[model samples]
Target: MCAKTLRSVHEHRKPASLRGRSFKRPTTGRFDINGDERKFKKKHSKANGIVSPMPNGKPTTSKKVNGMVNGVNGHAVVHMEDEADTSSGRGVATSSKYAAIQEQRANLPIARGETHSTIPAISIHDPSFATIGKEALLNEFREHDVTVLLGETGSGKTTQVPQYLLESGLAGEGMIAVTQPRRVAATSLAARVAAEQNGRVGSVVGYSVRFDERSSTDTRIKYLTDGMIFRELLSDPLLSKYSVVIVDEAHERSLRTDLLIANLKTIQQKRNDASQGKGKGKEKEKERLKIIIMSATLDAEKFAKFFPGSKIIYVQGRQHPVTIYHSAQGQLDYVDSAMRTFFQIHVDQPPGDVLIFLPGQEDIESLDNSIRLYANQLPPNQQEVLICTMYASQAPGQNAKVFNATPPNTRKCILATNIAETSITIPGVKYVIDTGKCKEKRYLAKNTGGGFDTLMTRDITKSSAMQRAGRAGREGPGFCFRLYTEESFKSMALSAEPEIMRSISALKTLFLIGGLDQSGEITQLGREMAAFPLEPVYSRAVLASKEYGCTNEVLTIIAVLSASSKVFVDSSEQRDAVAEARKKFKHGSGDHLTVLNVVRAYKDVALSENKSGRREWCRKHFLNERALLEANDIREQLQQTCERLGIDWKVSCGDGDEPVIQSFGQGLAMNTAFLQPDGTYKQTMGQSTVKIHPSSTLCDKKAPTIVYDEVVYTNQIYARGVSIISKSFLAGLGALKVRQA
Candidate 1:
C-alpha cells in the first residue's frame, strides 16, 4: 500500500552550503571529547580584525540575528574541545590529537555559521542540544541496552546522537549504524553528518542504499535504509560489526523497518548473551550490541514496552509557534481546496514560501497546473508564484530544482507528495497547506491464499496532520491551513498502524518461495536466496531459471523489474510516438518477454554506438537510460551471486522465449490465473477476478492461461507484467497447493 504523511521533522535537517571553506570557532571554554566538562585558558588571535562568522567569512545582504537568518546558519559556535595546548604558552601548537579536534570543530555546520564572537553557546535553539547535556545523554546510553528516545522534529537527535556516541568512544572498535526509512534521508543525512565531522562522505560517514552504496573500512558511523540493514542481517546474522544500531523514524514503521525491529530483538539477545558469557570484562562489553529506537510521535511508550527494560527519554524540539487554522467544513475536493488556499495565501498573506501537501503525484500535478494557470491571471503588482512539483517518480533534476533559491519578488510554492512530510527540510516554507488526505497501500488477503495490493485514498491520521503542519515551522514562525475541519482531525486515528499489520507478512512470502519450511524455519535455499538484494519471488525465479536453462534471459528481465524507475517514460503528448517505438520490442507473449527483447536490443546498440548515439537511441525509444543502467548494475550483482551459488548465470535457452516464460511460471505459480466464462480472468489460487492492465501488450488478447508479476487495485483489480502459459505447464507445478500457516 502507498502511505503518505504530512511534512514533519521525522529525522533530518537540511545542510547549508559550506562554500568550499572552513571557518574558525570562538575561543569558548574547553569541553571534554568524552562527554566531560573541562576548562582551559583562553588563547588570543594574532589578527585584531573581525572574521565574518559565515562560511568563507564573507558578508551578505541578508540580515542576521545572533549570526542566524531564519533559524539557519549564522554565528553559531560548536565547541568540541580546546584549540591549543594549555600546558604551555598560548602560542605553542598542540599535539596531533588537539589538531584533529580543532580541525573537526572548525568544520562543524554551526562553527561555519558563527562570526568572531566570545559568547559561549552550544546550540541553545535546538531542544535536544539545549536540554540534554552531552554527559547525561551518554550516561543513559551507556547504562541501557536499548533507548526509546521521543524527539520532536528539529530536535537534533537524528544528527547529533551519532556524533555524540562517536566522540564519547561509546561505539568502541565497531561501526555505529543509523537506519532511515527512505534512501534520500539516508544519503542526505550522511552528507550532513560528514560535513559536521569535517570529513568527506564514504570516509568518516557513509550511506548504503539499494543499487548505490558509498562506504568503506574508514567509515565509523554509517547511515543506511532499513532495507539495506535488513539485508545485511542475512550475511551477518548477529551484526557483529556494529556496536550500536539506531533505528530512526521508528514511528513510520515501514515493512522493512518492522522486520529489522523484530530481528534485532533476537539478534541482540544472542549477541549480548554470548558476550556476557565471555567473562564480563570491558572487551566483552564492547562485543555486545546497543539499540536506540527514535520516534517523532507519542509512540515511544509502545517501543519502550516492547523492549521491556528500555528507557524512554523525551527530548524537547526547537519549534516556533505554528498558527493552525481549520476549515469550517469538509473539503469534498482537496485539490480544488488546495488551489484556492494557495491563491488565498498568495493574494492575502505576507512574504514567504508556501508548502502544499497532496496525496499523490496525480493531485500534485493537478494542483500545480491550477496554481500556475491562476498565478498568471493575478495582477502584475503581486509576486509571481514559482511552482515546484515533488513525488517519488519525479526525475532527479526536477527534485533538485525544488531546493533552488526563490527569485526576487517571487513566492515559491512546493506541490509535494508525502515524501516531503518526513526527514527533509524545505527552506523558505513559512506557510503550509495540508490536504488531510493520503494514499495507503493495503494487501487484501484472500481466503484462498493469494492477495493483491490496494492503493486507496483515505483520511490521514492525527500524527500525520501534526507532521504536515510541522513543515512550516522548520525555518521560523509559520502558519498551517488545514483543508479539513478541526473535528475531522480530532476524529482521525492517533497514528498509523504498523506496516506488518496492514501488509502480507514477509515470512509468508518467504515461505511461498521455499525460503522457509512448513515449520516456519529458514532453509539453506532461503539463505542463498537472501544473498541477492532482490524480492524472494525474483530470487526464486533466478533459481528456477538455472533448471530451465534460461538463466541469462531471466536475469535481464528480473533486473529491469527490480529497477527503481519505470523502463518507459510515458507522456500524453508523445503517446503515439511511445506506442510506435514500443512496437519494435513488443512480444506476443506479454510484458516479461517484451522487457527481455528491449534489453537485448539495448545490448546490441551499446556494442555499435557511441555514448551520444546510445543516448539518442534511448531517447528515440522513450526508454529511461537510468533504469537501464541501474538494471545493468543489478544484473551484474545477481551474476556474481549466481556464480557464488554454483549456478551458471550464462546459461541460455538460445533465441527461444518458451523456457524463459516457463521459468517465470515456476516462481509465479501462485500469481497464475485462468480465463473465466465471462471473458475475464480468475486467479488460480484466489477467487478475485482481474483484468489485464491497459499498459500490458496482451491487454485485449484472449489468453486462456496467464501468470502475472503482481495485481494492483486502483479503479479496478488489474494484473500487470503478464505472460501467457500453457495450462499443462502450470499444472506441473504442484507447489501452488502449499497452504498458508
Candidate 2:
C-alpha cells in the first residue's frame, strides 16, 4: 500500500548530494560562506583507509580458476546532463526541449567517438573491439552462471556487455539489467548507450536513479544505480523481469554494491532452481538469471573464490603505455603543486587536454580559480586555458562542459575529485596530474547507531593511483605526473575497504527503524516501510504520523529532508543577506520546523504568484527553487502513499507543533541527544558529544533535548537537521505499537 512512497523516493533524481556513499569531495582549506578560508584540521581515523591530513585525499563474482591476487583496475565515468523536470523519453513525443538537448550532446568531445566509444563501428581502437570478440564473450557468459570479467579502463565493457546480451537474444523477452555504483554513471551510460542503439531513450534504453526514471515498456536494456535495484527488490524480489544482471565496477565495493552482490547470488540460486523444476506451477519454469561481475583490475581471484564454479576472464583494454614521474619530495599544498604542473604541461609539453585529480570539490574550485588566474597572466603566444570543475554536487549542466570540444588555441584543464579517476572518460587527455589524495565518508559506528559520518582526506590506494594514471592513456601514449614521491606510492594500500565492512550495516539501521524484529526477520511494519521510497527512519516517521494526526506536517518536513538538493542557497559574497533572509522562516524548534516554515511560505507564494513570481520570491529569499519544487513533488508522492495506506494525509494539527515533534521523535529515537551541563549536546543513546552544524538554524542555541537527522564530520562532529523536542515525548515514545511481519 505504501508502494508509492518507495517509488517516489527516487523519482526526483538530481544526483544525490555527496554523502553516505563513497564518492569524491575536496580537502585542505575550505571557504566559509563569508569568504574566509579556514584551514581544516585533519582528523585521522583507522576505519576506511588511513584517515590523515591534506597529504592526500584519498564486488562480486565467482569463478574457480586461480592466480595471484593482483591490483584491481577499471575506468568508467558518467556525463549525465541535468534534466530534473524532463521526461525519460527522447523523441518528438518527449519534452519539447529534448531535441535541443540531444543536438547539444552530439557535439560532446567523447561522443564523437574519437577515443573510447562503446559502439564498435565508431571505436576501432577500443581494446574490446580488437581482442574480445562479441560472439566469444557471449559464449563465456552463456556457459557460466557467473563470470568475473576483469578488464582495464576504456575496455568498452561497461557499455558493450548489455548490448551484446540484448542483440544476441540472451536476455530473452526480459530486460538486461546493468547496475552502477553512482547515479551519474547510470544516467550518462544510458544516454550513451541509447545514442549507440540509434533509438530514443526510454524506448530501447533508459536509466533509473533516485528520483529520476527514463524507461518504457519497450526498453530491453536498463541501467540503474545499486540503490535503485534494492527498491525494485522490495516489489520484485525475484527480479523476474530481467534475464541478465551485470554488476559494473565491482571492485569499488561501495556498501550498496556489496549488499547487491550478495543478494544477486541468492537470486541466481532461487531462479535457477525454479527453472530446473524445483518449484511448482509458474515457478517451475522461471527464467534463469545470469550474473556478470565486471572489474577493472586483474584481481579476479577474490571474486572467483566467492562464487563456486564461476569463470574468470581478463580482457585487455585500449590503454597505452603511460610514462610516470614522481615529485622529488612531498608538497604540503597539492593544489599549488597541481597549478604549477598544469602550466608546465600547457606551456612546455605536447598539445592535449590535462586532467588534475584532487581530493574533493573545495580543492577543485580552489584550483579552478588558480588556473584561470595564471592563464590570464600568460603571454598572447600561449594557448588560452578552459577550466572545468567536476564533483558530485556540481550542477549537471556545468559537469557536461568537461565533455565539450576544446576551442581553437585553447587547452582544456579539468579539476575534479577522484570522479575523474574512473566514472568518466574525457577525450584527448594526454597529461595526468595526481594529488595523491581524495575525500571519503566513513561511518564511525558506536553503540545505539549514534555513530557519525566523517569526510576525511587520505592517500589514494595503489589501485586508484593506477586508475588515475590510466586516464592519460585513453586514446594514446600519455604521461602521468605524481605530486608525491614514489616511496609514498608504495606505502599506499592496495584497495579501499569494502563499504559493508566500514559503513554501518543495513541490518542495524533496519532494526533501529523497526523494519526488523529481534530475530533478524523483516517485520510487517518493515514491509510497509519498504513500500515507500524513503529511508527506513523517514518511513517510520510517516507511519508514526498516523497516530499523531499530523501526517500533513510530517510528510512536508520529510519531503524537504529527502530532497537531493539543499533548501538554502549558499553564497559567500551575500552571506549576511542570506542569513537575514533565512530569518523570515526561522523557528525556535530548529532546522526541521524552519524548513516547514519555508515550505509553508513557498506554498503561499505559489498560490498567489506566477512561475516568474515564485522564482523571484525564492531568489529574494536566498532559497533554492529547484529543491522546493523537488520537495513539493516528493510531498505529493508521500501524500499518495499515505492515502494508499489508508492514512489521512490531509489531517493536520494546524498551529500546534507538539504532535508533529512527537511523531518525529519516534522515528529519530536513535538520533536524539540532550544538552550536557558543559553546554555540549550528548547523544542519548551513545553519549557522544556533538555540535549543531553551523548551517542549522539552532546552531549554538541551547535546546534542552534535541533530535537531529544526521551527524557529519568535517573539522568536528556536527549534527545537521536539528530540532528541539520535549523529554516527556521521548519517554512516551515506547508506547508506540510495534507490529510483526
Candidate 3:
C-alpha cells in the first residue's frame, strides 16, 4: 500500500549533494558547489487577493505572476546565507560559546544538511539519520520530489523533522522555522519541542503568537502560526537565519502558506545575487534555504513541480482497519437515521470514544437533541453517556467540554463540525461517525455589487474523509466508521479550495509598510506583515491603526477576534438587548461599526465597576466575557505595534468606539452584491444568482444591507437582501436603504 511506499521513498534515495562531497568547502569557495543543474525551485499558479508591487512604486504588480487571480508575485522570501558558505561575518557555528548551544540541541529534531543549501557533510553529522529503505526512497521520494507527509494523527514527523535537520548538521547557520495553520498547533508544538530539549520554553524551542511568546535569546526551534512567519520575512529577507522552513498542513491551503512559498523562493534567488555581488551584512553565508512541505492529502508532486529541485517524502498514515458503512435504509431522513446510528454505535461498539462529524451548528444541535432524546429512551442507569457538540460558532465553554473526556462507565459522543478535520486533537477518541457533509463558504465569481454573500452545505472531500479517519487511530490502532461509501469519496476533490478566490484580502495595511505602499506587491508594510503573529487581514487592521491614529484600540479589537476567539453569547434575547443598546450609535455603517459600538459600551461598563462587575455587564447583554478579554488583548498588541512603528497609540472610547463607518463600508462592500427588481441579485463586479443569508440581524428587515457570510455559514448573503451598498461599499456608508425609493 501507499504507507509502504512512503517509507521506501525516504529510506532509499541518497541526497543529491552526495555526489559533490569532494568539493565541499567551509562557507564560500566556489559557485560550482552552489550552482546545480536544478537550483531554482519549481513554480505554481498563484491565488488571488495577495499583495503585489504596483507599477508606480506601489503595491499592485504590472503583470499577475503565475495563476494568481488577484495581483501578487508568487514566492516566499526565505533568508539566505552567504553563497557557498564563505567565511561568514555572523555565523551560528564557528563561534565559541554557541558551540555548547549547538551541542545541546543534538537531541532536537532537524533536517540533514550542513547549511540549508548543502546536505549532510562527513565532518557535519552523518547523512543517514533514519534509514527509510533504499528502493523505496529511489522509487517514491526521488520519483516525485514532493513529499506528502500523511502520517496518522499522532506521528512524530510534525515535531521531529526540524530537529532531525539540526542534529544532522544541516542548517547550522540559523534557526529552523515551522509554520502551523492554527495558533494551538504553534503553542503546543513549541512547548513539546522545548520539553524534549530540556531547555525552558523560551530557550531552545519557542513560539511567537499574537499576544504571547515563549521565545528568548537561546531559542533555535520556533513554532509559529503561518502568518507570523510570513511577516518575519519582511525584516529578514532570505530568512537567512533559518536552515529549513517546514510548511505544515499545506492541504488546507490557508492564505498565508500559499503566499509564503512564492516569497521564500524569491528570497532564495535574491540571496544568491547579493552574496555573488557587493551586498554587505551577513550576506556571505551562501545557501538557498531548503523548504520541507508537510501536507496531509494535497498533491505533493504539484508542489514538487512548483519548486524545482526540492525533495518530497511521503509518510503513510497509521490507521486501524475500521469498517466504513453507509447510511443503512432511511439514512436520507435527517434525525431518524443519524440518531439511530448514534445509539447503535454507543451501545454496541467497542469501549473507545466516538466522534461524529456533522455539517453546521444546526446539524450539530439537531443531532445533539436527538441523542439526548435517545438517552431518555434508555433504561435508568443502563448507560450513562456523555455527549458534546463541536462547531465553529459555539460558545467557548461548551466547545472546551467537548475536547475533554467523560467520567468512568460513561461513554463519550462528540458531535462535531469541520473544525475536527485538522484543528483540534481529542485525546481518547477511537471511533468516528461521519455525516459525509460540510458547510463551506463559496464566492460567486460574478457578484461584485458587494452587499452580501452565500454558503452551501456540500459533500466532504476525500482528503477530509481521510483526515477524519486518521483522527480515530491517533493514539493507537483506532477505527473510523464512515457514513459514506468509498465510491462517493472517489468523486470528491483532492483538496480544499484556495483562500484568495474566497476570502477577503487586506490591501489597506500593505500600503502602510515602509517598502510597500500598495495592495499589489510586497513592500516594507507587506514585509512587516510577514513578521507579525496574526493573519494578514487582522495584521492589516492592526497595522492600519497607525494611519487612522487608533493603534491602541485596534490592537485590542483584533486580538479578541482571531482564530477560535469570537465571543458571541447564546441567548438571543440578551444578544438582541445588547445589540439594541449598541444600535443607538449605529451610523448604519455596517456590522464592524456595530462591534465597535459594543466595545465602547463595554469600556463604559468596565470603568463603572471592578473586573467581576465588567463580567456582569457582559452577562446582562448576552455578550461573552472572554470576548471582552480578547478585545483587551487586541488593544495591547495594537499598542505594541504602535511602539514598534513609532505610531502614537492613545486608547480612548470617544465616539463610543465607532469607526468612520463609511470607510469600513468601502472595504466590506467590494465583494458584496445587490438584489435586482426580479429578485435575482446582481453581484459586485458583475456576477449573479447570489442571495442574502438568513442569519443577518437585517434578515427580516426590508432595507438592503451588506453582510459577512452566507446562510450555511452565518446566513446573511445567499437568501435575500437588497443591494443598497456598493459592491465596494458602493452605496456609501450612512446611506440607509429603505423599502424602494
Best by TM-score: 1
Each prediction's TM-score versus the true structure: 0.79, 0.75, 0.67
lDDT of each: 0.73, 0.71, 0.53
Task: State which candidate has the highest lDDT.
Answer: 1
For every model in order, what is the number of clashing pairs? 11, 34, 125
What RMSD does each model have against the real structure?
14.3, 12.2, 18.7
lDDT of 2 by residue, 544-570 (tens): 988999989999999998988777866
Error at 74, model 1, angstroms:
4.4
Q: What's the C-alpha lDDT at position 416 in model 2?
A: 84
Please list the residue runs of candidate 3 whose C-alpha ends up more than 4 Å from where it truly belongs after superposition. Answer: 1-150, 272-286, 316-321, 327-330, 447-452, 501-564, 571-593, 608-613, 639-653, 656-659, 666-741
Provide the global lDDT of candidate 2 against the true structure.
0.71
lDDT of 1 at 646: 96
Encode model 3's per-residue lDDT on 468-574: one tens digit a residue: 76566544445555555444555667667777668653343234222244346676666665545565645554555555555555555455555245555653325
